[model samples]
Target: MKEIVKFSFISILFILGINIVSFSQSPNESSLGIQIEKNPEFRDVELYELKITQVFKIGNQGKDSIVLKAPTTMQIQSPQLGLKIDTIIGVSRYKVAQNQLIIYFSKDKIYDFEIFYSYFGNVANLNLIGGNLGSFYYWDANEEFWYFRSTNTKINEISISYPNNFYLLESFSNSKDIISEGTNKETFISRSIQNIPLQFILLNKLKYERKRVVKSNQYLYIYLPIDSTRNLYLNKNNIVKKIESQFDKVICFFDEVTSRNIDVIQIDYNKKGRALGNQIICDSSFFYTHHLLHEFIHVYSEIRTVKNDSGYFFLEESLTEFLAICLNYNSKNRDIYFDRKIAYYSNKSHANKSIFEVDKNSNENWDLIYGKTPFIIHLLSLRLNENEIYRILKDFYIHYSKKEVTFDDFSLFLRNQSVDKEVFSEFIRLL
Candidate 1:
């Protein structure tokens, strides 16, 4: 009897130990948000899969129940898009669609799971400032709801393998020139530019001028789309030539931002001042001659960074803004773009700090990463040589591409090149 009791106790302890090892402290503990981990292997232009098990720490401040709630449905969506894959699942495993799944963990527990499928279009993150992940209610959990800034985003087609009836009927613009159609049937694709694979259609028909701006090494890349009808044309040959000239391999991607991901440029007109930087989805009412030059420099330099839907908010837009201000401000491509005002509203910290400064506190607020970072870069340009500045910027992009370069990457690049690190460091310190 004594031996049996001891054996039972040992077994219980062993099981408990296994459970503890299965999970670590949730990263979402402080914020109660989520983090998406990319799949280890690349499946063509497949975007990173969010391992739902990859624990996303929920923010403690907002609706605390985000952790406790067993969500009945999840919709990956935007205001322009009603496209979603919503299903209800609890403790049981759910093989809802072809490539997606839902598995359950214990309370305050997390694990990694995957939904694998080919992408129909783009996958973008919805930004809900001051919103907590827990605020998104799962009808089952009775959680409070929080609002998000639903800009024009890339919505993927999950049911392509399903019957054609499941897929959204695509519509295109009647006039190839009409860029936007004020919330038409299709979310991202122009209404008139219809009946074709959007990636192929966008790649083939898109044509925009390089806007005769001379490159002096340092430059900015801005994609500006005008009107609610976001149609920007690109002559395939020009695109091929320019892209081939810069990158060793060129690919036209409809969704996902890795090495060669490009999206329809969207910029704001005179009115609202919410999400800033180059609007990736909507068309800008006014086009800047220098905008092409700035964007060209990013591709030309082969700034081989893995930018996602939010990368523009995090790095690309701020860097592009900084580079554009420095290059366009001095170049002949200058034009009145009062409509495309700079507000680093998308990712605020970068708007205020050094271009490479990683946000120490993920939950902090920022409104200037777009506007202010450029001024700092411009200031740096004043002290550094245009050629040196250009080389530095290019090197920064290339070196960072080798790995994720933080603000420290800039410091490391300077040291590795044996350039006087102080030249740029002093500028950063001053800022």
Candidate 2:
């Protein structure tokens, strides 16, 4: 099955080209329309490869030319063999840019175009079934949402067709937005959701498993692949206990909790750690580590800060890491972690650079964000107790939960945190 998947994917890689079918129509008033059709197919469910056929209908009803920038692939992970443009109708010309298709339409014409493309989406987490006879594949389609730019382009609808046996596990869409759900297909109509993106998860239920644990204020869902079910079952009790304990600690430190459903999906792919909203997707190996806790803290500490803001990485990533380490480890281990981080940062070229100088867009500044910023927080924790640190953080969270904040705002908040002026000034100098 795996070999078949690989062969099919490889064969599709070389089939890239535009098959243009041209037609003409009378020009009309300026307007644009969009409709998307998505078909996800799995020749063998045991393999992680999913073949997706995406058909886009773009109607340009204008007297002038227009250019549209359409994304080639929506998933964060690039397509295995790039997208193949199987068919194109009513397009003057198109060229591939970096992960985008710059399509051109001629002036004084009406074009009702259709673009059919296929790409292999390898975003699924593997679940072996019946000792490798078959497998169940699951993945979140959160990043599968389409993004295109055009003036006054109205999306008609998006239709998704999957295997009849596949299940729509979860979605962030309103139930009313789901226009139709037949045996093998689902359609979502874009009524007033022009600004919101659709998010969903799909899974094959043959060997997939999920556990839901409801606490007093929070609901947790743990999704495990079939191969890991035995180990998960054995550790289920301890897992729940530890999660609850961590939740309590976080709530206690923050003095508040957001009552929402959190999904922790154990993915098979290496280096797949991601935390968005209340969802935590990570490799199975990091499930019980502080890394997971770091992601968890992000949910509670998320602020509406822009990437251009000074110390944006410090406020988001570093502070979250500091709190996660504090909650997950004792003083001894925490000290060791901070010492290692300090050592790493000390060797970096930007060791002496202030946290305010870290650019969120530059990969080179990541060490400062992850190492020096957290160590700075650790140093502050030494001058003031952890409880005091949590109090200040709790106050900061309250002030900027859903509001935009900058490093200057945070620095000011810390300076006013009722700590000793000399100690606070010393900590401010570290940043």
Candidate 3:
């Protein structure tokens, strides 16, 4: 009976806590906001350790205690900074859990204090990709960009400072006070930090030849090392034209115009080939026409506004491969494509596992996810007309483009389409 009462009391507190967070205003005000300063020191070529300093202020508005959420990655320096005012006490305790740094303290009558800490590490949010010309990093690519406070926390002001030689090339920031010094320092201040992802490019000024190719309703931005000869220069334009033609065919099939600009980075010394959705990082040796189209198909299928982790491979990988086949089916390589596709699907390693269970991180058995799953889509296309199959996919795209999607969601879409019930039944059974 005692244990039951304890559980009941805890459940009541949980319910009340949810209600309090939902309905009531927080009993704390930002007297002095957070100021974050980051300095990056190069450890090696394109690798650096960043020292981040964050100073924050909190004022207790009521006589009741309050808690604030910080990043779990935050390392608080010992001997916390604050005065021991009767009303305004320092943070008495802190706990890290659920990806949150929970700060606890006793409330004083409108008392405030400042806390500061410095941490040194490789900024996971920042990646320095080096090419023959130079290196650059994208602000949006950092998963841990907002390392100070939890989202939805009202920050009155924010200021971030970068290195001296880093040029703020492009900014999608809504923050004001955007300034750049002659020595190549950039700083921006925001009154209220918007709860949106920050995406910008910070480029170290280097000698490079950049070609901006604009074709019919599509754009390609290519960056190459300036050391290339005139013949290689012409080859660069030819590569761009070939990729543009391939993209044109995909776009024409989908009946969708290009929504985002594509960037290709060609570095002679860097041979790490990758397609980062909108950006392609490759050496000229690996930047062939087929490789370009494979990556561009990924760019075409990036309809999700927010990523849904589970079963996202269906749209990102499987659908992409299926579309690639469609793109080549009418071409001269039709027989070759089908032969390779059959061999890939017939590989017996992952025959037992369902394609719906496949993930992007499946390394050894990636052929199951990327290669075998296309057969499902192929079967659907064979059951229905090609146009009707694309219509179903496009309809799925329209519904889940701006939102996360799941395997269940895809199944429902297939069932709800204007196709034969037997066909849909067979598809679901195969899954």
lDDT per residue for candidate 1 within 321-393, as digits (tens), equals 5565545454322222211443323344344444345443133423345444555555566566666776776
Clashing pairs in 3: 87-108
Error of 2 at 69 (Å): 2.3
Model with the higher lDDT, candidate 1 or 3? 3
What ranges in model 1 sit over 4 Å off? Answer: 1-279, 289-316, 327-367
Worst 10 residues of 1 by lDDT: 9-18
Please, what is the whole-model Cα lDDT of each candidate in the order they appear? Answer: 0.31, 0.57, 0.51
lDDT of 3 by residue, 311-335 (tens): 6676677777777666655534644
TM-score of 1: 0.36
TM-score of each: 0.36, 0.64, 0.64
Off by over 4 Å in 3: 1-116, 121-126, 131-133, 138-146, 154-201, 204-207, 214-220, 227-234, 246-262, 267-278, 283-286, 289-310, 324-335
Q: Count backbone overlaps in model 2.
A: 0
Candidate 2 per-residue lDDT, tens place, 301-393, comes to: 647666688778787788887888888888789899888778767987778888787665366877777778788888999889877886787
Pick by TM-score: 1 or 3, better one: 3
